[model samples]
Target: MHRLLFALDPEEAHELTLRVLSLWSERGPLLEVPARLLRVEDPRLQVEALGLRFPNPLGLAAGMDKDARALGAWWALGFGFAEVGTLTPRPQEGNPRPRLFRLVEDRALINRMGFNNRGAEEVARRLWRFRERGLAFPVGVNLGKNRDTPLERAAEDYLRALQALEPYGDYFVLNVSSPNTPGLRTLQEGPFLDELLSQLRPATPKPLLLKVAPDLSWEALDQVVELCRKHGLEGLVAVNTTLERPGLQSPWAREAGGLSGRPLKGKALEVLRHLSRVEGLTLVSVGGVEGPEDVWERLKLGARLVQVYTGLVYGGPLFPRRVLKGLLKLMEAEGVRRLEEVWPPIP
Candidate 1:
């Protein structure tokens, strides 16, 4: 069944996925689904990050549910948190058809999605409805500027999305790293980043997290840490998908988009280690995290929490819970009590 899903063209596969997801939403999450293959009972796995308590440290990363439409089903799947959207101030069709490609040979994906979303207002409206009924866990909103929006006015777009969706989300992710959007990653520059965050950060009380690209230099990472500290932001989602293709085996490796999955493991871990050195910054490690070993490795390096998107897509519905279970086994073996203890002490 899953193989058939992957066999189709990326766009067709995505549409089929959406249709299947819509059906699941209508039926709602199966609470009694049981942790048959996935683990859900680990006392030592509870964690608190980004001003919110998570039942466990593993979360569903952004881009999985771009419209906030499947909060109930995902939460039921046992994720500690679910970050939704790269939603813009207005709706966009995104780049074009075939923007998403799977590199099965390398267990990766390349997507130039261009932040396509139902616009922030609609996203907020649906989120409000979800909350009104009740969401099973914390849901963070990922904000981005529209593609045609000029870089100078990007903050305006982010602020608009933030202000409009503020009441709906438990947290916010400033997605200045998605390579699909033109000039988006440039916002990582110290001056441009400061300009944007200065305008948008103070307006929201929710824990604001900056999502950065994995390909940043040490100097750039240092500057971003300084900027976040200056703005009084809560944390950073260290290392979004990378554009580099060093050891890729997939034919789609040359695709014109950010590459994510196992291929990104080494560089993403390095970035996590570097960012971990920054005092007083909580880091949510993302990119190339495939299993419990990957999660444990990130925590050892310096991640307060971890998020997975590509891994889930490749590993199927039980990925997050399976990873969490494996994390519990690792913790038990290592005599660790809490996920926080897995973090390396600041030197």
Candidate 2:
């Protein structure tokens, strides 16, 4: 069954899966019927962060269900939260097809699937309906500029998208680090980031975070931390996919895009370890969180929450439950009485 999906073109498989889940999302209480079997509703897994409560630390990262199509399905799959979109103010075609690649040998993926989302307003409408369901799942909106937006005016794109999405999301993420968008990564620089954060911080009272790149220099990373603080932003989603393809075995390694999954574990952890040390920011670790131990490590390293993308593509729908169960075992071994007690963002 899984082999059929793996055999299909990555994007095709993704769309096919989303279509099925989108239908399932419309099922209302039926979604919870599966939740009874799939969701591991332990009080120990509850997490409080960004002034909102999450059922667990595990989240479906942005770029997966870009249109908020499978939200109810995600909750049924047992993800504590989900972040959708790298949405722009306007819809886009994104980079041409065959833009997403799978690296099975490396348990990884490479995607330059630009910010190809159905614009903010359309997605907001979908979210509004999802909100009416009143599920406890926390959804995050990750905002980005359109492919054609000038780097100088990128803040305008984010601001407009935020205005459309603000009332819906539990939190909002500024996704300036996606490599597929030309000049997008430059938004991480000192002045540009400072300006971007300055403009966006005042836009919403919702929890706002900056998602950073895995390939950044330590100094550049620190510059981002300082600017986030300077702007009074909430926290960060550490280490988005990396452009550097270090020691990859797949032929897809040559593809021009950000590489994620196990290949990104070290760099993601490295960045998380660094950013987690900062005084106040809540770090949401992404990049390559595959299994239960991966989430535990991120929590220990200072990530108040963690997100997964490539891992899900390879691990299948039951991945969330498996990891959540494994996490419980680890917690029991560590004698952790509660998830919150174990994750004070260890130095």
Candidate 3:
């Protein structure tokens, strides 16, 4: 199944995969057998962050289920939480086709998919439908501005999305970090960030998080961290797909877009470690996490939660379950029962 899916166009293959998950969602209880076998039910895996409880620390990252199509399936797949979207106030066609690429040798993906979705209203409706049936775990909405929206008016786009989806989301992510959108990363600068956050923060009912680019320097990152703190932001998702392409063995490596997967792990971890030093912020570690060991390392490094997207593409449906089991083993071996005890004391 994995091999066949990989052979098709990346976006098309992704759609087909979603369809499969949607089937599982419709059937509902059909997933119970798999869930029972795969779920790791340790009290230690339960995580309380952003005023909500996650059955485990691992979650599906944004961009995977952009439209909230299979919320139930993600829960059944054993993910503790799922972030849907990069959804905009208005629906976008996104960048031209062939925007998503796979570097199989590197176990990575590079995508310039510019927040393509059915728009905020559609996503909110989908969330409502999912919620009517009841959500099994926490869900976050990753908000983005439309491509044509000017930088000066960007906050309006985010505010609009926040208003539309707030009722259904457990948390909200203000995504100013995606490299594919024109001038989107500029929002990370202090003045723009402050302006954006100031407008939305007061009105936001849920825990608001800032998703930042990994390419930022320590100085730039410091500014962002401080800004998030000043604005009363609750959490940060360290390291979106990077613009910088390090050593690469794939022919498609030169293609333009953000690079995610193993290459991002080191930088993502570095950023996570930096953010963990600050008090009053929950850090969500993403990028290059592939297995139980990676999840364990992120926990020890001070990530309150870990998210996986590219890893899911490479690791398959059973991946999250395997990681949870691996986490259980690591926890037992270390003689720690709770995720809070896993982190090393900040120096």
Best by lDDT: 2
Per residue, candidate 1 scores C-alpha lDDT tens digits across 186-233 of 999988999998998888888998999988888988899999999988
lDDT of each: 0.84, 0.91, 0.90
Residue range 50-149, candidate 3, lDDT tens digits: 8889999999999999999888888887999999999999999999989999998888899999888999999999899888986568999999999999
Question: Which ranges in model 1 have alpha carbons more than 4 Å from their true place?
Answer: 26-39, 344-347
How would the candidate models be sorted by TM-score, starting from the highest? Answer: 2, 3, 1
* Model 2 / residue 316 / CA error / Å: 0.5
Taking all chains together, the TM-score of candidate 1 against the true structure is 0.94
Assess the local accuracy of residue 343 in candidate 3 as a C-alpha lDDT between 0 and 100.
64
TM-score of each model, in listed order: 0.94, 0.98, 0.97
Candidate 1, residue 312: the lDDT equals: 83
lDDT string for model 2 (60-108, tens) is 9999999999999999999999999989999998999889999999999
Question: How far is 232's C-alpha from truth in model 2 (Å)?
Answer: 0.6
Off by over 4 Å in 3: 343-347
